[model samples]
Target: MLNRYNPHAMHQGYYRYPTISGDTVAFVCEDDLWTVPVEGGIARRLTTSLSMVITPRYSPDGQWLAFVARDEGHPEVYVMPAEGGEPRRLTYQGAERVEVVGWTPDGDEVIYNSTAGRPPREVVLWRVSLEGGLPTQYPYGLANHISFGPNGAILLGRHTGDPARWKRYRGGTAGVFWIDRTGSGEFTRFQPTDGDLTAPMWIGERIYFVSDHEGIANIYSCLPDGADLQRHTHHEEYYVRYPSTDGKRIVYHAGADLYVLDLATGENRLIPVELRSPRTQAQRKFVETDKYLQEYTLHPQGHSLLLTVRGKPFTMGNWEGAVLQYGEPQGVRYRLSRFLNDGTRIITVSDASGEPCLELHTPDGVTRFEAFDIGHPYRLEVCPTADRIALSNHRFELHLFDIEQRTLQLVERSEYGMIEGFAWSPCGRWLAYSFAPNERTHIIKIYDTETGAIHPITQPEFRDVLPAWDPDGEMLYFISLRDYDPVPDNLQFEMAFPMGMRVMAVVLRKDIPNPLLPPPRPFEETK
Candidate 1:
């Protein structure tokens, strides 16, 4: 029950990998992905991915299972069959999305990193061909944490020049190169007498890397000819991520959890894991659902609310700065708005010309009000008789603005394929939505503001849809995924899902009126 916006506090063990039968050692507890026996006791599961499989690795003859799935849409690179089915994609199209960072000792080939169209802040290594087609550019220069070495040699996190301006001689630099898989030049470079080294592991002649130099970042080893540079573990404020290995212990990520280290008794364990779950969080606090609320809006007497968030230095200003601020206090990206029909004002999204509109506040100031250019708009609704303002669009569409005739209207278009939540009924004329398509199905449908036609209802099972309608509009309250993914006698995520399958609720029309029937109240206010 510890979910004050949940920030870690629920982890068991397992996590650590290296099997392909080097005697066995793979771990990822609960939703499947295990493999112990490196001389220990029981532990076996090895393959599963319905919604989240991650960084698995194994294929130097362990048959095949080179991971990275994220359900689909961004993180790609699959191979499956280490006893699973239908997986094989191995990096496709790309334009800023294709992770699968390393594997090549005769696993046929695999090494990835992307930004598909080339520049979204650099990160471009590619070298596919596991008996398939396309993918072969490992030129070196704009790199990022790739790794290969059992003997094929190739390790990354590079950047020699032209990163729009480069800058770094002592403020946390990052170098660790050594190429030759066909992107030749014998590259060689490792200079980090201290600080700036990330995700580098090879283990044998040494090359364990992950450093903030000595001010934090920990786990270091080096010797790809850079010679004896040891410094293996002295944490300091926890930050390491991705430093893996299977040649007998070494795995990383220290605050997004997951940790291990035993390259011969320097012990460090904490494999009670999480691995990578901070898409964004800092002094965090979150909760929103006017159908996934984001751009803010809702007044005309439905109580109050107009939040925006990203204020007070929420960060951004070091692309070597020259007037490149994105969001935060000074940029005014904060929109903790509130309204219940003109008793006040408050609405914000900010950053107008660079797109992300709407602004209108009132402690007596801020009044830019334009609306939707989209960069993350999420569920906002206001329609009291079509005075309009509907929103939700990270490309699932929906739109519909008119805020007193300013003009706009896309009106709806998700097609049961990736629109996570939406609602509008209280007499504003029928809307209710929620979808997903394949994390085990999550439908919901229902549109029709005067016959634009939709109507789906129930027929979605397997958790997480989220909609909530009926303050007098027939009924709809969502969340589903009842049970499936709880195998953690010790952490696991080889292909995640099953760490407790959350999000549940269902009732198509028991006479409507269960807006989540009382079960969430108490955010501290007990006088």
Candidate 2:
């Protein structure tokens, strides 16, 4: 029996998504991505400053690397010079919705699924050139994770035209199949096993897939001709993810740690390094530099957490920390008023006046402590230190307010587009803001308070938004959508990915306040 509420202690040894190649293996744990040598050496840190980086695929030539980065500005595919240079964005044409599923044999193009068209969306396969050219859509429909076999045929996660299967397929119980690049071939189902099959890896004539038929995810291998069934391992607790093979060993992530399985002997081995628990060890030492984990949780103190989750216009509201269902029929819109460090007084941007204004309130009375006639403070943001509040104004400029001094400081004066989200670094030294237009296309920018310099974190093409800072402020997580076509005839929203939500973490100067602010002050008796 456990006596303490230590969330970190219980989750110390879990690693995730391991990939092996010769002597090198890579995986992500607690949002940090790492790689190590297979000959029993220390693991090296790949990326720790971002909230989440997943679906990492090494180029066939082994000279380039690609992965999906869910940065605050967009969820797009990024490629770094294999030896390690700043990552270059590949797709910038769609919404904040896309996925990188397969790499072409030539290593010159990436195959991915995107939702570029309509609702009840279709996941269409699209290819982006590594050499930088316009993306071309494959004619197939309802497909995912496309892998080009040696013969140039594509292996895909089967898409059922019937709506019944769509509703029941969440725990990854989808069928794998083959299809041509053009929409002419019939959808032939691959495996009908009781377990859900996903992330299909094809090597020679043997088809390998990850399934959870025995109640735990594990790797299973079968011949493409549908013969010879083999169960590789007996490990029942850890989840087997992203099974990939170069016609040799099957590699994947076991509990965020990298692992490789020998096809000849059917044995498994763990990578030398383990990912630190996201709940504890906000930072950990790797072979050289330290890797950090990004965690997103509500600022437990209140006010700072607003839920615009349920609404008509969907304006913001304050998270008062307590669930009070009374008078105005509070909708999901919320904003950070004041924290306990100052008092229980909450501030919010509401449609009280003709134009939107900042309003302050307390539990005791409905009297207003402060009000500002700001236009459309859509994304209300507050800095925990220095008593500052910020909001996106009508002209697409970010307006900062000094709550105590009653002065406004223009932190970011931008006319680029509407601001989507903003977060302060843990140490309050910098601010990260994501912006896009009402129609969906934008940029995520990072500003240094000390140097007054602005760094654009994303490429100009993809629409990225929703930046959430990791607990340690080392990474920021946002959504990215790509593969856009502006032709009205081609614009059908047919590319909507089934996996819509992605989490990213950006490295920040430091970690911010959790259970934010000090405790609330005791109520004074009014005589």
Candidate 3:
């Protein structure tokens, strides 16, 4: 069976690192690539990696997508079609912490950042051809996220302070913004400030970057020569993170929502993204439960076993048979699962509706009974003949529950220790069980439903325990130490009754005569 969630449910998660091309805004979400319209409508997923995809950049022609995916156990460069398809790997150096900055203006190579040199301390920029080859290192020292100017210049952003990390960090190591007025390697700081500045981009003639000089991270722009510094956005609660532009409009994410800033009209509006992807990782994952398995109960028919795996109920079959796992809502813990008589419905004890209850499930739906007032149950057995169930709790109490009326009635309580075993009669009117009265001796007793009387079937002198009813309900079987065959020890002055245990049976009705006895008495020559 396919486990699927609500496809029509619309929710907004952390929409991060958006790059815009035309009216389509490609972004990173759920650790995969997704694209939504700038006008804000239903979003479509591009990749199914679920493997920490970051920094998606659109090609200049808006035909291909370049991003970084760690699906292969490490971050590497990968590119796919803008409309969603199988992504082809471009970089396979097995380098650590690779981030795709952006694509070259010509759309022939992808630019990214990684550790450089032998020891690899300072981060530098490298570009790899889209035709699959080794990446060539860019000459500028200490440059990560770089963008090409409209007039063939360089707008390189160095390390920037994260407002999400350090709120008001204005000290050194904040960030350094470098500008290359020409294509030459010469670089200089663009309007030095004490605040953290990152996410640099070059749209048209303005140099845009994120800064926190005003105590809150927002988008700011300046001319190429570091003149006319102006703040464009006024975000107060959350700092801006990873803003990208498509030479016309800027797409970025701040706080938990995505925002689009139009450089032409200077209008920034919040884009309500309708993100509803099949997040399989959140629903399915590997879990080691061999050491965590606490209990398992074999079904009465021997076709399956009721298992409490990590406090959840699952039914498993023998050898290549199917495994049926019951589903529960989020944050609900279910335990102690069993099948009712006839094996049509499953019964489970859960705390789902803010209180402890007994949940009954079948093909139709679920039915809950909140009057299940038992605590820490050790055994939950449904009567083999009726809708009633037998429950034994840690409080040394036995409870009788009605399935139809949703009522709980106390059957008995053990003052010395817990009730060892219980078996319901075929008529569902009698319950036979064994319990120790004082730690020294245990006896079997039967409770009659028609008459409110408890009858003891064995003497207290003999420790009779674990009474079970025959299929006919006319006889009872128990284990006792009545038969004695004492033997003296050779090395010590002690005698041990090694052959004392014997299976004992009691006939309830004297009318149950065995005709096969006395050798059937058929050879009397009555003919």
Candidate 4:
């Protein structure tokens, strides 16, 4: 087991894009290139560029190393000797982003992917000769990463969706495909599944790849024809990312530590690579907080503004007072800071006690209230009466907490799904919320505290949301998608309803007149 607390351990983090060639493995660590032996030992820094460098690939013959560097303010390809020397610049197309895929089998050229002079969503592969010249674009349209097979066919990994953002994604563009490079534009997709698959490596008779079909991503191997599939690694904690093979051994990263898998014995072993460079990035450094302002809200009396900067809450004056930070303890995260009814006390949800709890900040200091630990709460709302708090949990159960009595109450539980868009009335005697009866449309509903009655305000014909109570306690206002003005398409004559929403107000009493109607004029007495 790797000691995570040790600073000098191989699991110090920030190592990425591992490429193996013979007995050496080159990878990017903190905007520089470094190489370690396959058996694992002290790593030697190869490039000391000021800018960010990434995606290092060793030449097929192990004589040169090609990687992407942002020295000129944009990513471009550069090649250097395998034993650490001056890097020669390649690819002058000036792309905003470029990545070194791998070297051509002959070692005289390098294959890379770039998004230059094309749409941002599209990436085209190119081959640039090591002797320095313009690149030749491959015919493949949107390939992200590629590896050449023994027969010159290309094994492509296309990211139709973001792998990191969308976990356990099983969409149309989540699998690897084989592209015949012999002028045939013929493409064959791999086995179909609803799991994310990537990092295609064609080694010998088997094609190795990474798949999350078994819950967590692990190394898997299959034949060239997508037959005889087998799982190689059974890691369940962290996903095995960026696996590279030099035909003899497979190297990959699992939870910040590199592991090497011998193809002959199928034995996986950890490679303890000790980094000798100055650990400048792990040290503490000062950062300007004004640029990272996230959430802000106006003060109740409009005298100041409540702002959250880098998880710390602050109050800045509208015209007079200076900025005052809440000065919470370090390592504590406070979210959704809100002012109570009097504006003298601030209420926020914090995880300072390990689990999330409600905290009250006032002139008397901070006081924590333990109101029925439901783990972490969301969409916390303070009542106008200042004695009750409303919130929802991850399980979609709405709750109400009595501040003074230190008691909890279950407001409403959704049997169909989650109930959202809840608001308190001015008198704090009722709560209005919206939920979908079916899965099609959301309807507004009101809950009365005095009568304990729940009834729907709107029908199921349209979706209504964001309910707000009128200050006079006589009307309710909400947004509804009832307007259906459809615009015809110019090319196909198809009608498209483009987000027609309107604000609507409903009188709580039956005797109330329409607010938008013209008022009646008084008649003069017959004189």
Best by TM-score: 4
Instruction: Residues 223-296, candidate 4: write the lDDT tens digits.
Output: 77777888878776887877777778778777766777777777777667788778777677787866887777
* Model 4: how far residue 330 lies from native, Å: 2.2
**TM-score, per-candidate, Cα-based:** 0.27, 0.48, 0.53, 0.78
Q: Name the lDDT value of residue 520 in candidate 1.
A: 70
The sequence of per-residue lDDT tens digits that candidate 2 reaches over residues 241-297 is: 666665578777655445677776666765455333345454544442112211111
Winning candidate number (lDDT)? 3
RMSD of each: 23.1, 21.2, 17.8, 4.8
Error of 2 at 265 (Å): 2.9
Lowest summed lDDT window (length 10), candidate 1: 160-169
Native-to-model Cα distance after best TM-score fit, residue 204 in candidate 2, in Å = 1.6
3 or 4, greater by lDDT: 3
Question: Candidate 1, residues 355-380: lDDT per residue as tens digits?
Answer: 67765555566666554464467656
Among all windows of 10 consecutive residues in model 3, the one with the lowest summed lDDT is 1-10
**Worst-scoring 10-residue span by lDDT in model 4:** 1-10
Candidate 3 C-alpha lDDT tens digits along 395-504: 87878887777888887888877877788887888988886777767788888756857888877787787788888899998888787778997766899887888888
The candidate 2 region of ten consecutive residues with least summed lDDT is: 288-297
Cα RMSD of predicted structure 1: 23.1
